[model samples]
Every structure is written in structure tokens, then in C-alpha cells.
Target: MEKHLNIPISADEIRDLKVGESVLLSGIMITGRDAVHKWIHDTFIDKTKPATQEDLDTLSQLKPILDGGLIYHCGPVVSGLETKQYRFVAAGPTTSIREEPYQGDVIHFLNLRGVIGKGGMGPKTLKACHDAPAVYFHAIGGAAALIAESVTEVIGVHKLEFGIPEAIWVIKVKDLPVIVTMDSHNASLHTSVRDQSKSILNRLIEG
Candidate 1:
């Protein structure tokens, strides 16, 4: 099925999605990657260290935005950085499997409805999607420049000390195309493909 969705997607809306569905998303989503994921896990989920005032402040700002919202695993190439008029030159997705350790917890903690990235996540994230009633939206990997066209505006950014790539960028998008590769029903296209490939390889070897 093809659907057009807006950010701050409801849990019910996310639950309706299924693997292999195409979607065009509009509205706000925050960009996060490895450093942001690790920080969120360590500071918020695991509680390995006490959150600083800055951390708390950032969380306070993000909580409402992320509640029933999407997080994109993107490290965009940006321009006009010094002027603070940021524009995404290329906003492509990064590998999502690296976030496997933190994604599940992050989804639950943030009340996230979706995760957008390239490639796919693992069993942990799949289980999280089932439990949290979330979904994983797969973005195209090589179409960085093309994807940037969807980013209508840069609302703001946080944790600039993490550098441009790792900072959490809040953006508004229009008609951002994605495919549901993992769904709240515990379906994962990635797992299916992997298993099918393995089966094929085994059959060839046996023959």
C-alpha cells in the first residue's frame, strides 16, 4: 500500500503500516546517528552516567518532538554553517545496523513511531518495533542530493559540539519517500531476504 503521512505520526497510524509499503512523509523529523544514539543510550536508557543540565535541556526539547515521531539516521552534508542558515546539500541515510544496540531502548524511551535509515536493523530493533508499535522506514542510500530536496527547512539543531554530522538536526520535510521494511507486526523484509538467500545458497551447495 502507498500512504502519505505527516510527522508526529500516531501509534495507531504506525500499526497500520506493513512491510513493503511505500510512504511519503511530511512534517518534522530529527536526524540522529551513531554518536547521538550512544549518547541517548548512555545518558537516558542505561543511566550509566547522570545527565547534565545540558543533556536534560536537550531531552526536554526533543521529548515532545519525538513522541510519536520519526528519527532519521542521516549525516547530511550541509552548507551555510557559519551563517547559521543551514541547508542540506546531501541528506542520505547511513547504515542502521550499527544502531542495533541502542535503537530498541531509544524507541521505547522516546515514544518514537518510526526510524528512517538505509539498509536495515536487526532482531533487537524488529522486536522493538513489535513491542513499541513502531516501524522502520528505509530511505535510498545513493540518492543523497535528491533526498535533500525533501528537506524544506532546518528548524534547528542541538549538540553542535558533536559536529555537523553527528548533531541532532530538526528538519521539516515534504514528501520524503520511504519504504516500510520493518513493521509493528514483527515483519522484517531484511530478515526475509537474508533467510531466502541463505536457503538458496544451501540448496546450491547440496545440489
Candidate 2:
């Protein structure tokens, strides 16, 4: 049987992936943005506080949680207690490019193999896709309620100090279907469509 992970995979698997294949991701996905990225690198990577080697391992391996996985460009809603098993309200995509600065480093460091979002990522992330063989998956934007269903569980959270909208959340999900908007071969649908449109426009003008 094909092993389909539920959601939020692990760091190691993300590094080893292909261009056009589907996966059912499972495990814990950490939600964050520019602020959270800065926070993680500064605090977690730098060991701002004392942490055991195992803790550091988990921290660095964060992105692979989505390896052969999905990355929601979302900032989720925190409507429950901070206990171990609290489910949040709605989690959806935030602009992915804001992560450009750290996405490459994060993917490189954690072996990120996939990402899902509304507006796709930027150049650095694109290069990372080439270097890392990752794919940028596009999820249905504005479908917060539907998206929530894919999330089977909320394992917990981290760095709540960054606060909501920019915190590192541990979210678990399953059987999430997304489109391959970008691929490891450095192919981009957005650019392809744009070029096709431009060609059609020029042809019409010449005729």
C-alpha cells in the first residue's frame, strides 16, 4: 500500500522528494510567518535558552513535518486553552513570500520538501525548490472551514510569546489535496500562464 502521511510530516523526509507526486501528509506542522521565522532562528536555533540535544533536533527538523507534506501559509485562530489537546478555530494561508528570507534556510536546514499556500512563494524559495526538490502546493484560499476539516488534530503549540498570527503552532492534519503550483524543476504555473497570455495578446495585435 502506498504510505500516505496525514499532515505535518517530519524534517528528514522533506529533503528527499519528487516533482509531481501526491502525498497524504500527517504529523505536526508548525504555523509561522516572517515574525515567527525570525523568532525561531533567533530563539530556537540560537538556543536562546537551555535545551537538550533532543529538543534542538526537533526544532531544526521542524519543516520536514511538511516534507512530502503541505505548508499552509496561514495564521490560525487560537480559541482554546494552551493545554496539550486544544483545537483551534480556523487556520488558513498567509502570503508565502514573506517567508522568502528564511524559507531557503529553513528548507535547507530542516529539509523542507513541500509548501502549500494561496499566493505562491518568491525567488529564494523557488531556488530552494530547485536546490531542495520541493514543490509549492496551492490550497483553496478563503475556505477556512473546509481547511479546518483536513486538520485532524492540534498536537499543541510553541513560542506563543510571538502571539497569534505569528506564533509557531503544532498542527496535525490528514488527506489534504492541493495543486502543484510550483515544482522542483523550477517550473511555475503562474509564470507559464502569464507567458501564454502575453503571447496570445501579441498575436492578436499582429493579426
User: After best superposition, candidate 1 residue 56: deviation in angstroms?
Assistant: 0.5
Report the error of model 1 at residue 53, Å.
Answer: 0.5
Question: How much lDDT does each candidate structure score?
Answer: 0.95, 0.66
lDDT of 2 by residue, 1-207 (tens): 233654444434444344444555556666767776665555555556566675566565664464544445678776666454567677767778777777776666555666777677777888888887677767667777777777878776666666776766777777655666777777777667778999999999997
Residues 1-207, model 1: lDDT tens digits: 569999889888998999999999999999999999999999988999899999999999999999999999999999999999999999999999999999999999999998999899999999999999899999999789889999999999999999999999999999999999999998999999999999999999998
Candidate 1 is scored at a TM of: 0.97
Cα lDDT, model 2, residue 4 = 68
Candidate 2 achieves a global lDDT of 0.66
Q: Model 2: residues >4 Å from true position, as ranges? A: 1-24, 41-71, 82-85, 197-207
* Candidate that would win on lDDT: 1
